[model samples]
Target: MSSIKSPRQIAESLTELWSPRVVAEVDDAYIKVAKVQGSLAWHSHEGEDELFFILKGRLRIEMDDGAVELGEGEMFVVPKGVRHNPVAESECQLMLIERKTTQHTGNVVTEKTRSLSDQLRPV
Candidate 1:
């Protein structure tokens, strides 16, 4: 079993975008904390869904269909194989929930995909 997590505390420790720090994990899923700004690449998980919960600022999810804006205390789920890009106009803190094996950049394996093994840490 794992311990409880305090995302606020975990988020406080993060200082950059695309650099997520694991705050907790359950089974094959991981809860990560990140600070973000600017635009992220368009990508999609092959077989897993990803959830984004905004804790401190605004986040925008851009999809081929449309754009979804999330504010503090808001969240949205990006379903499997659905291409989307996340963007933030200002610094924001958020939690990302997805399978541990899920690629950070989904189908787009660019330099931006921070190696999952390198950024994960036990809560």
Candidate 2:
């Protein structure tokens, strides 16, 4: 099953804030999109690097040392073992690229956390 896919369009179809939906896979990585607002718990993936690509709106990734702000058409990568929290003052659409074995929310678990199975659900 292969076809043209729009990350933005798939991101727009997402309704659950912070719940990322898996859209595709490339080797050991999973490409996911999420519609989010507010903040996700501070966490770190010990063995995986996380990539965030903004599709719409703005995002600020708060880290222990500092924070980075990203707007539409921007992207950032949180290296493995760096604690960070993603915050969006308003609704935001973004895509994520992470290892298939990466845990959602990493070492921290919260109500907003979505498991791999949940993320794999169709949009």
Q: Report the C-alpha displacement of residue 53, candidate 2, in angstroms.
A: 0.3
* Candidate 1 vs. true structure, TM-score: 0.91
Candidate 2, residue 119: lDDT: 96
lDDT of 1 by residue, 20-114 (tens): 88877778898888888888799999899999999899999999999999999999999999999999999889999989888888879776678
Write model 2 residue lDDT over 32-70, tens digit each, in one string: 999999999999999999999999999999999999999
Top candidate on TM-score is: 2
Clashing pairs in 2: none
Global lDDT of each candidate: 0.86, 0.96
- Model 1 has an lDDT value of 0.86
